[model samples]
Every structure is written in structure tokens, then in C-alpha cells.
Target: MLHPILPLILFAFVATATPGIATTLSTASGAQFGFRRSVPLMIGSAAGLATVTGAAAAGLAGLLLAMPSLQLAMKIAGSLYLLWLALKIGRAGPPNLDVTMAKPNSFFGGAGIQWMNPKGWAMGLGAAASFAALADGPGQLALLLGSTFGLTAAVSLSLWCVAGMVLARLLKTEWQWRALNIVLALVLAASIIPMWRTV
Candidate 1:
């Protein structure tokens, strides 16, 4: 049982660390706003991941997957939000590197992204499905999966943030800043494809 569960933890780490909507957003946020302002986003993303994992353990994933309309709605809403965020990132100007002039991505915004994110759903569902048999009870299984996901997500997201912060130093001029923003925006836009396919 422990052996099997250990692999799931590794899976969570790999999944969260992989380039996806959440990681892309975290990187962009860290680059634009720095580490301090991005803390809430990281925390919120972890919380949201835990919530999704719990929901999956409780069998909500199947219900959501079965309902095509609900899945479609989520995909549309998530994609639109990502596009809006991309627009904001693209238009942003270089601010005082120490003091962010633009509003940073908030806790709710981070959580909301997970709520609508299809990859998040898939991860939760996969975790729950994979680990359900190891626990003594459904509640225990849910708690275990949720905690595993939450911790991995927090760590992985923070790593991405740190990467962005390091890269932020490269934007010496306004044009460099703009160019980085455009690239981030393009990456965000490209993420929509996976979301669309997941639904």
C-alpha cells in the first residue's frame, strides 16, 4: 500500500511541475509581481487543488465528466478567463521591479483558475481513482489524496514562481519587458488547446 501511494505522490509532483495553465500563470505572476505578491496565488492554488482532489475522491469527477454541458461550460469559462489574463499580461508595462504597479494575481483568482481548469480536474480524478483501493475508508482516501496533491502543488508552483523571479532580472529595458510579457501571453493562449481537448 505504501509503495503504491509513494508513486502517486511522485505523480502529483510531476503533474504539478509540468507546464500547464497554473504553472504558466504562476511564472507570469512571479515575473511581473515578484515573489512576495505571488504568495497568495501559490497558497490559493494549493487550496484549490486540495478541494478538487477531495471532490474527485467523493466521485464528483465522474458526475462532472458525464455532464457534457457542465464540462463545456467550464472549458469556455476557463479559456475566456485565461485569454483575459493573457491580454492583461500583454498590455502591462515595466513597473518598479521592487514595487509592482499592476495589481497582482489574487488568492481568489488563483483558486478560480483551478476551479475551471480541466487539467486540474483530470489530475484530481486520476489521483482519486488510482489510490482509492489503498485506504481503509473513502474519507481517509480523500484526505490522503487531497493532502498529497496540495503539498505537491504548493511546492511545484513555488518552484515555477522562483524560476520567473530569476528570469525577471533579464528584462532590463521596456522593450525586453514587453517582449517577455508577449511571450508569456502567447504561452497562456496556447494552454487553451489542452483545456479544450480535456473537455
Candidate 2:
């Protein structure tokens, strides 16, 4: 049973670390506002993922699966939100050299993204489903899964933010910042492919 969970932990790490809307936004925030300002968003993302994990362990995924229409509605709503985020990222201006002037991604925005993120739902549900039988009770299973997800999400988001900070130094000019923002926005938009397939 422990052995099975080891693999799941690894999967969680990879899934969280991979570039997604959350990571992209974290990176963007870090580039624009630096690490300190991005902490709230990172914490919010972890909290949001923890909530998803808890929901999955409590059988919310099963409920969603049973109601195909509801699931479809959620997917559509999530996709639209992602597109809107992409648009915002695309239009974002160059980073303000003065930290005081920088407008970073907010805690609520980060949490809201995870709440409506289809990938987050899939990952949480998949993890819970894969590990359900290993635990003795729903509560125990939820605690384990939620802790694992929250830890991984926090670490992964921080790494992405650090990477963005590094990249921020390289983007010395407005054009470079604008170009990178566009690329990140495109990546965010492309992330909708998985959700579209489910639709």
C-alpha cells in the first residue's frame, strides 16, 4: 500500500511541476512583482489544490461523473475562464522596475483559477481514485491526498516563480517582456486542449 502511494506522490509532483495555468501565472507574477509579492498567490494555489483533493476523496468526482451534464458545464466554464486569463496575460504590460508600481496576481485570483481549472480537477480525481483503496477511511484518505497535493503544489509553484525571476533578469527591454507574456498567454490558451477533449 505504501509502495503504491509512493508512485502517486511522484505523479503528483510531476503533475504539479509541469507548466500549466497555475504555474504560468505564478511565473508571470514572479517576473512582474518578484518572489515576495507572489507568495500569497502560491499559498492560495496550494490551498485551492488541497480543496480539490479533499473534494475528490469525499467522492465529489463520482458525483460529477454521474452527472455528465454538470461535468460538461464545469468543463465549459473552466475553459472560458482559462481563455479570459490568457487574454489578461497577453495584454499585461512590461514589469515595473519599481516594485511599488507592479500589480501582481492576487491570492483570490490564484485560488479561483484552481477552483475552475479542469486539469486540477482531473489530477485531483485521478489521484484520489488511484489511492482510495489504500486507505482505511475517507477521512484518512483525504488527509493524505490533500497534504500530498498541497505540498507538491506549493513547491512546484515556488519553483516556477523562481524560474520566472531568473528570466526576468534576461528580459531587459519592453519588447522582450511583451514577447514572453504573449508566449505564456499562448501556452495558457493551449492548455484548454485536454478540457476540449473531454467536451
Best by TM-score: 1
| lDDT to native, each model | 0.85, 0.81
lDDT of 2 by residue, 99-159 (tens): 3324676787788777776567777778877888867988888888888898999999999
Residue 194 in candidate 2 has what lDDT? 71
**Tens-place lDDT digits, model 1, residues 83-171:** 99888888776756423337788898888889888778887887877878877876887788888888999999999998889888877
Model 1, residue 31: distance off in Å is 1.1
What is the TM-score of each predicted model, taking all chains together? 0.93, 0.89
How many residue pairs clash in each candidate at the backbone level? 0, 0
Error of 2 at 130 (Å): 1.8
Q: Candidate 1 — which residues are off by over 4 angstroms?
A: 1-4, 97-101
